[model samples]
Target: MTVDQLPPAPAGSPPPARPGAGRTLIRGLGQLLITAGVVVLLFVVYEIWVTDLFGAQKQAAATEEVDEAWAAAAQTQAPQTDTVVVTDPAQLVTDPRERTPTYQTLTGQGFAKISIPAFGADYQFTIVEGTSDDDLYVGPGHYPESQMPGEQGNFAVAGHRVSKGSPFNDLGLLNSCDSVIIETQDDWFVYRVLPMPEEIPTWSSTAPTRPLCADVSVLPSPYEQTVGREITLPSDYAQILPVPGISDATVPADAQRLITLTTCHPQFSAAERMIVHGVLTKSYAKAPGFLPPEMGEA
Candidate 1:
């Protein structure tokens, strides 16, 4: 057939480029990205709001369980208490060994409540017997290896700074001398954050928290009172030492009772850790018809 006379080539179907596998793949990839984005948004929601709600519920239940246990301990009562009257907590409350109530338990169940007035007068959480993932998911978790509250060693705890109820969300806001109280069925353990070393008085040859500082030097160093503090890497475990940051600290003898509060640094990221160190300034025994003055504060 001559060129002009050739039967009009069938207007062939559009070329492959016009509507091909590549276009379909591109469309599919776009859809996948959109779906992925939605999934990420949903996950963030679950991490923030959902986890807090769920954690609040879990903490409520945990507190109930702990309270019941406390009741049992209260009822079983040792009618006798130490003859030593606490005229002033800063001095009288000091007991190098375990103090009144003998409140220490290894069960996963919470045995006490942690109240940080700085966080808020109403802020409180149950402290369960471990810092394991499962333990922390419910509430603030006490390090299994750490000492109990009011003990003459590092009574350390780990909590979530965000999500899982964000129990320690405002931990960084805690200033020097701020109270980090622990209430057991038997006693009220009040610990004041210790100041940084330089902030300590010139008289103390060792860490002011240990070997017992008679003055206000026991409270957190002035540096710690600054609005925002430095973050430490996870590998920096000395923050929980008997005398925080002092690995060779002679605990119980050279060291006074202390508490170490730890949580994730910043907000959502776990890149580093936030640590708060305190000295046991008050150990008021929980007795029949009695509450510490701090607890009574409105």
Candidate 2:
């Protein structure tokens, strides 16, 4: 019989297996997948371990240095005054040069520490100096135009609520009459929290003025066009203060120097902001009497 007609080689010559083709293909694909997985694992490890660990260590060292610098400055300028009075809020200053070594160190190391016992905040944070686009997610922000901690108008600080390192995590838990204390290398300032008016929406409100409802409706006015309207201060009377949308003309007048602590509300979402307003009660230099346990001999 002719070869072509020989019953197709008993119907099962094993199809002449493709000479290592399957093995070579599988080996190549396996190697590619393994390489990709290894690369991904390495990146995740770096992010979870190296970045966080090294970053945190660097920040801590920087903070210590900043604290030392601030202590030195206070010693030279104030000479450990027996008493610190807050008679004039406008006199308080946040001199860049006077920042504690800790402040400078943390700031340079990509974080800043913000502690307020009233709100239960004691965390290291990134610093965002303003409320603009370039200022989000970095840290608790310091309103540059606002007064310092002991200042008269309002020293406002804002931070994330649910971030792992939430610097203002407990701000929402504060009740009226709570004690809010902020500390640095040079001084510790204490404040008394107060209740904000119910009708005053959170600072996250985008309305041009206070919003009004049927029982608490806002009145229409021409002052809505004013510039710097977004700037809210502790001294602003409820009636004239820009509410984003609601209007009230008979709110109580502002009297005391204010310090406002703001953080994201409802835990994980940025949908709203919780605000804790306080009035400065006392302040003292960071002497032995004012130092925390961890501060050592400072």
- Evaluate all candidate structures by whole-model CA lDDT and list the values in order: 0.70, 0.47
- How well does model 2 score by local distance difference test? 0.47
lDDT of 1 by residue, 1-298 (tens): 1211323444765433344676667777877888999999999999899998988888898999989888877667654555334444444343535564466576567988998876767888999988888788889998877677877778888998878888888877766667778988777887776665445455355545543333335334322332123478988776776656655444645456778888887677778998877777777766555545555332
Lowest lDDT block of 10, candidate 2: 211-220
lDDT (0-100) at residue 108 of candidate 2? 25
For model 1 the local lDDT of residue 38 reads 95
What TM-score does candidate 1 reach?
0.76
List residue ranges in candidate 2 displaced over 4 A.
Answer: 1-62, 78-113, 118-139, 196-255, 289-298
C-alpha RMSD of each candidate structure in angstroms? 9.0, 12.6
